[model samples]
Target: MTLGIDVVRAAPKVLLHDHLDGGLRPQTIAELAAGIGHELPVADPAGLGGWFAEAADSGSLERYLETFEHTVAVMQSAEALTRVARECVEDLAADGVVYAEIRYAPEQHVSAGLTLDEVVAAVQQGFDEASASGGIVVRQLLTAMRHQARSREIAELAVAWRDRGVAGFDIAGAEAGNPPTRHLDAFEYLQRENAHFTIHAGEAFGLPSIWQALQWCGADRLGHGVRIVDDITVHPDGTAELGRLAAYVRDKRIPLEMCPASNVQTGAADSIAEHPIGLLTRLGFRVTVNTDNRLMSNTSMSKEMHALCEAFDYGLADLRWFTINAMKSAFLPFDQRLALINDVIKPGYDKF
Candidate 1:
């Protein structure tokens, strides 16, 4: 039997889809904006929160992304990046996230005159400081912008910081016009270096993007792979049929970093009540729940799990599976990942 919502909220969670730039504290944004003299859509924290939610609910990824202008505007300095990263750890720890990998494109933060190496160092320092004080273990995923031609540089950057704090690499931003294959050189380089990377695919785009990411670009995982559902077919007898790509993904246990609230906001799904998370979970797709953006989507790991339970009637067993799935998909080493599952995740699930 499943415990109540409180028990669920207290369950140890693993997050893989959180963005470093997207989960900024509203107060931090206001303070950073003030320091940089950048104008904001809203000043008060309460109003700023509402502004982000409302702006992101526009149902168009392009329009929804316009909101990041204000966020990225203030994250130009080392001090600002460090503060945001530290706060991200503190907030995730409070939400019962035991392990999280936060992703951000370093090139975006360089417009304010900081070097790419400086941007990575500042965020890494903040993560180290926050983890020293907090109970959560936070890792960084250095991201390359898909629209730009800097994936190889970002991949090298992630490798350069592998010993510091960066756990892996990723390609983010508008996945429509730009495909992961555009950065094949970067993925090839990372492959040669024996590095890990996840590609943002099948969110706003369809399966071709996903196919290329996995087959051509060789992504270790898929971000917002909600569209993989397109490859599945339901028969009159209610048995599910998986297309070749879907079956390969399932057979290989490639992780799908599904962010339900963010998916709904970006029109990846119609609504929370009608998301494919339940279907994907039932089909054993190695689905893991996450908060893509805390400020923009106004979400956390606890809130995201609670919403999943409400949407799919999930219980402790289902929640535990999600936790294990995330731990399996994390870029951490195998022994450490198993230790976390045995010592932390399973014990919490048993308590519930």
Candidate 2:
């Protein structure tokens, strides 16, 4: 049975990859920008929202990333960070996201005289406040910009705050020249400390990026590993073959955090229907759906699931599988993950 959008929206979801800075409410951006005297391409909230979607749809990873200038500009202070983070939780909860890991680079928010620790504290404050009354549980994943040299510093920060609320660490940026191995020291630190991290690979780049992220950097999960499809070849008689690397990924159950809408906007895929997720899911790979950037992609977890149902003819069982896959792949403790799967996710989906 084809689930309607409303039904999909009501299904409990788990988001493994979402950008805190990229999911700001349009109205909040307008108010905050005006308060700080930051100039935006469009002053009105509606126009600004449309502008971001259009600007980020440039079909180039670098150009797509450039849309963050305005959002990041308005988020320099503690008040702004707290407010944005709180609203992010509220919004995700309303969208039926029972669990999520929101990521952002602390280095980018420190230009306002705040230290890296202070930046994390402010964002955590927001998450805590919203989670107090909660239907949702939210955690932070501190990200280090791949082009920067502060990854080791950020890794330490994540470990320092792991008990406070920070769940893990990550590195994300242009995937062309800045390979994941550049941050080998940071990943090594995380591994030694028994921390978890996901590397942004196989998105704009190809198999080499994925190979380095897993083989050299030792990432726990792959961020946007859509390009793993390149390693798989299909025959006309409907058989498929997986190359060595692809076979390894599937064999080990490495989760691919696939963002369909964002991938299409960034030219990683032509359209949602043509996305590699369909092929990957069919091949029995551990695939989880996500909204990499809500404002930039104009998407939510519900919208992403609904789109997939339309594209792949998925039903509630399929949606349940994706949510379970995400919860299993989360950086949360094994016991906690099991509880959410048995107590929350599976039961919630059974209601449908």
Best candidate (score: lDDT): 2
* lDDT, model 1, position 318: 85
- Clash totals for all models, in order? 0, 0
Candidate 2 structure quality by residue, lDDT tens digits, 116-208: 999999999999999899678899999999999999999999999999999999999989999999999999999999999999999999999
Cα lDDT, model 2, residue 72: 93
The TM-scores, one per candidate, come to 0.97, 0.99
- List, residue by residue over 1-352, the lDDT tens digit for candidate 1: 3346677778999999999888888888888998879888889978988888888987766657877888889889999999999888988888888999999999999997999999999998888888897567889999999999999999999999998888899999888899898999999999999999999999989999999999999999999899999999989997999999999999999999999999889888888878888888989899999999988888888888888878788877888999999999999989989999998989888875
Error of 2 at 64 (Å): 2.4
Q: What is the C-alpha RMSD of each candidate to the true structure, in Å?
A: 1.3, 0.9
Residue 248 Cα positional deviation in candidate 1, in Å, after optimal superposition: 0.5
Note the residue pairs that clash in candidate 1. none
RMSD of 2: 0.9
| Cα TM-score of candidate 1 | 0.97
Give candidate 2 misplaced runs (Cα > 4 Å): 60-63
